[model samples]
Target: MLRDSVTAASADRAARGRAARKRVPRSAHGTWIPAADRPDPVGLLQAQGRDRLPELLPVRYARMAASPLAFLRGGAAVMAADLAAQPHTGLTVQLCGDAHLLNFGLYAAPERPLLFDLNDFDETFPGPFEWDVKRLAASVAVAARENGHKEEHVFGAARAAAGQYREAVRRLARQGELTVWYQHIDADLLLPLVRSGRRRRRTEATLTRARRRTSLQALGKLTETVGGRRRIIHDPPLLEPAGAMDTASLRKIFSDYRSTLPEERRLLLDRYRFVDAARKVVGVGSVGVRCFIVLLSGRDADDPLFLQIKQAGPSVLEEHLPSGPYVHPGRRVVAGQRLMQAAGDAFLGWTTGPEGRAFYWRQLHDMKASADVAGMSPGELRAYARLCGTALARAHARSGDRVAIAAYLGGADTFERAVGDFALRYTERNADDHAALGAAVVAGVVPAAPGV
Candidate 1:
């Protein structure tokens, strides 16, 4: 009876996927037109910062105004509102919410292979799967243009990402549950893709750098001996020591966060005594949030571990989509990360921070790495785009009806082509929005601190 029930449910889901195409045809996905009453992009960005620290707001504005690509990275709220106004195929999935090209990267876990997957989850929520696909495509287009690629190359890169997303989703649809669940993109997969000698060496070097990005490696760069003991160095506006009050707050929250972890991880965590901590700035979108780095030592001074405690806010997609399972913002981020990543972090957890704000804890850098999109050649960018697309499709399969999405996408390139068209059109608006932020800075409407 259980097996019969499961099969019947899947059949109905597949039928629902196919039925969605009638209401919003796959061809409709290619179009992008701004609504008459679209909210002011700058106003949307400012509204998201209502709860953020006032001091670091300038840094966020500066980083976002640096370039069009940077604007796209930080403008998730603006993009979310725009996409909500568009017609979408109703195949819902747990979206990364901000699935830009850079967000998909190499993530390393203890004792497991280095797998590439979506690493950022601040805006993760369940919504139409195509929203993520469109965002990814738009990011590729913007990056390609910034890299000075011609029109043909730009379209090619965008189409490549969308095409791979469609194909990967279709392949997963044909797979059984465990197969899709267990699937991971091993770092070794990158080796075969780069056939040329020079590119191979570059790729190898990048991988080598990632392997060395552990907490032990960070000891020298982020800290120094101060009066015969290691302490986090003060870098002013970016990295500063969490003073007495913040330090005490962190200590009190430690026990609450520790209980959220698994028993084994909690035991392992107990071995390391907290030594020093600092307030650190991170990411374009996450700049003004309360993010802190903790230093822990184990066995001896040589052994070290770094953990990041980042404040969590409501997802940018929350207003447009139905309410999700998690009521707490921090728990939502941790849960979404666990569901999407093939092999999730053992130390990931969430808890309430000072003033009842939500925050999540995770290992700072377990050998993480992201691609250098600014330097990629056109061919390399296209290949990287396709790989990112494949990885995203794999993540979606874990939380959505894969068979239904595949049926809606069909066995054709129509979806990909349409998305490519949409990406090109969308980037035009992104350019104007980016300019608007810069113009606001010039007009003194909002203060900015450049080159941070």
Candidate 2:
């Protein structure tokens, strides 16, 4: 009787998913006509910068103006508004919110093997699952073009991403809840496909580099033996000493973040003693945000741990979608990351900082691995695109009604093909937006300092 009830519930959810097709047909997903009154993309970016450091706004523009892909990375707010304008599948899940090619990478939880998965979560929030998929597809299309892949390969890569996502979702929907819960993409899983000897060696080297990226490794690169003691190196405008007040504030908030961790982890953290802190600039989209690196010593001066504290603002999707369960943006990011990533950081925590800003903390590096999209060949790009799609599907399945979403996707290539079309169309729009930003920089409408 219990088994029968579970079956009945699944059937009902599947029916609801199918019913959604009538409201927004699969073909409808192919469209991307900007509304006649679409807001100017630059103006939208300017608005996003209002909360950022005014002195650093030019850096954001310069980074964004670097390429169409860079523009897309920093232009999540613009795309969020655009995606909100369209009809959705209404199949909700915790979204990566900015699921671009670069964002899906390899990293490991404390004392675990590396796994390739979604690593960025600053914009994470619950929303229609397709928003994440579409973002990934669009990014693949843009990167392929930037890499000089032909149009045929461009469409092929985009379609591969959508196709793998659909296939993975269908597979996950049939698995037991526990099976889905424990599923993870081993970072080495893609090795079987690298038939070329040289490429295989390069891939292995990349993985080895990722594994070596521990806190100890960070100690060497980010710190120096200053006046017979270790200190965070100062490289003004990028990395600088956090003034005395800021340093004290970070120390004060350490306890609050400690409270959010598991008891055992708290005991582990208590072993470390604060040493120094520094403000650091990071990422294309994340530039100008309040981010700091906290250095701590454990056991002895030789045993060091680095934790990054980044201010969390409302997600770009916040205005368009309903508010997420966590009111504190830092908590929302931490919670969303824990839910999506197969393995999580041992030190992941959140707290409110000076001026009531929400901030989240986690080990630096956290042992990250991201693809060099600029260096990938057409075939390499396609394979990586498919892997990202599968990772995204697994994350969505863990959080959403996988059976229903599988039903919505159906067993046809129709949706994937339509998404390919959407990718190309949106790529055109994205290129134009990128060009406008460049124009703004040239006309002095916006400040820009390239090569920073």
Candidate 3:
């Protein structure tokens, strides 16, 4: 009787949430107007560069200036500010914060099945759930445009993604909490959903490639024999040796990180001894950040482990949304990843770097593969967009009030079309922002290495 009463009260609250949010209406989310006090987009990019590694800022800008889609991927802060100014449902969730198309991927779970999910959580924090949906929908439009698709197709892709998200959320909301929590989309289950054609073949190939990306495979590709020892090969501007101090301080940092892991994981990690470390420039937005690849060896040179220690700064949403409870930004990322992902890296942990910067550690490229957006056909793009939407909804349902969100979306195309419209306009704005950044590069206002 008590359980029934509690369920009734919860349903009432969800119903109230739906009605309250409808006052703002889903269509209201379609508009985007720059505030008079809005920060200049290029200026915002420059502001972010201030605290990053000075030498690598040019590489970051060069990557962003390459294309409009690249610019969108790199400018999470710019988009965060824009989204914050737009109408929101006022429903908060732990967001990916940078949920662009490329961030969703295939990764192997500890149980060995390859699963598709959100693989990046750098900017994650509690924020308006629609912010992530907007970012994702906009990315689809931008990517479709970059692929030379017609404007109608671009908008169609965006609408399909939003529609999938709405439907997935509603479906998940009806399931029991344990069922929702344990749910995952594996490659076997996903491949059948795609029509049997070139798209299916492409996805199969990606899964095959991902399965080969184990620690052993990485050890062979990234290391070499040096003075009878296996050491990471240095490839400058992409991969290079961290200086002497890095070697000296890493022992302490590694110990501190091990302490953060659970006892079983700590015991598992104890077998490997740190061998060498390297500074690696990674991703569009993360190029200037302090990212390092640490090499560890177990019994022999053939048995190795690669851990990526990435610097964690404040979330892009931190300035616009309610502050999260975490004092350590690395812990914030780890916690968010654990809460959202069905399964996370076994070595996932956090520690302070030598210079007091908070950093999160995770296994580097453990059977991970991202979608080949550059090569996707119009049909494939639409299909991939829908998959991303479903994966995102699953992630959000794990943390957000799914019943309330499902109620707010209701059973209509209104929210989907509104999101599609927003995506179209934002893609145009992203192009303009890309042009502005490109001009800054040419004018030498922002230094850039064009081919890098």
Every model's TM-score: 0.97, 0.98, 0.97
Q: Per-residue lDDT of 1-452 in model 1, one digit per residue for the tens?
A: 99999888878878888899898888888878999999999999888888998899999999999999999999999999999998777788999999999898887866757878899999999999999999999999999999999999999999999999999999999889999999999887776667668888888887888888888999888999989999988998899999999988999999999999999999999999999999999999899999999999999989999999999989999999899999999999999999998888888999898899999999888878887788678888899999999999999999998999998988889889999999999899999999999999999887799888
- Candidate 1, residue 111: CA error in Å? 2.1
Q: Total backbone clashes of model 1? A: 0
Report RMSD (Å) for each prediction in the order shown.
1.5, 1.1, 1.4
Q: What is the TM-score (0 to 1) of candidate 3?
A: 0.97
lDDT of 2 by residue, 1-452 (tens): 99999999999989988987987788788877887888899999998888788788889999999999999989998899889989898889999999998998889866678899998999999999999998999999999999999999999999999999999999999999999999999998867656678788888888889988887998899889978999999888899999999999999999999999999999999999999999998898998899999999999988989999999999999999876798999999999999999989999999999889999999887668776678678898899889999999999998999999999999998889888999999999999999999999999999998888
lDDT of 1 at 260: 91
Q: lDDT per residue, candidate 3, 1-452, as tens digits?
A: 99999799779858965974666688877776766788899999999988799999999999999999999999999999998876677787889999998899988888888899999999999987888998999999999999999888999999988999999999998898899999999866557656758877877888889999988999888889899888889898889898888777776799999998999999999999889999899999888999999999888778889999999999989998777989899999999999899888899999998778999999997899887788566777888899999999999999998888888988989998999999999998899999999999989999998677
Off by over 4 Å in 1: 1-10
True-structure lDDT of candidate 2:
0.91
- Candidate 3 Cα outliers beyond 4 Å, as residue runs: 193-199
Clashes of 3: 0
Q: Please tell me which model should have the higher TM-score, number 1 or number 2.
A: 2
TM-score of 2: 0.98
Clashing pairs in 3: none
What's model 1's lDDT at 358? 97
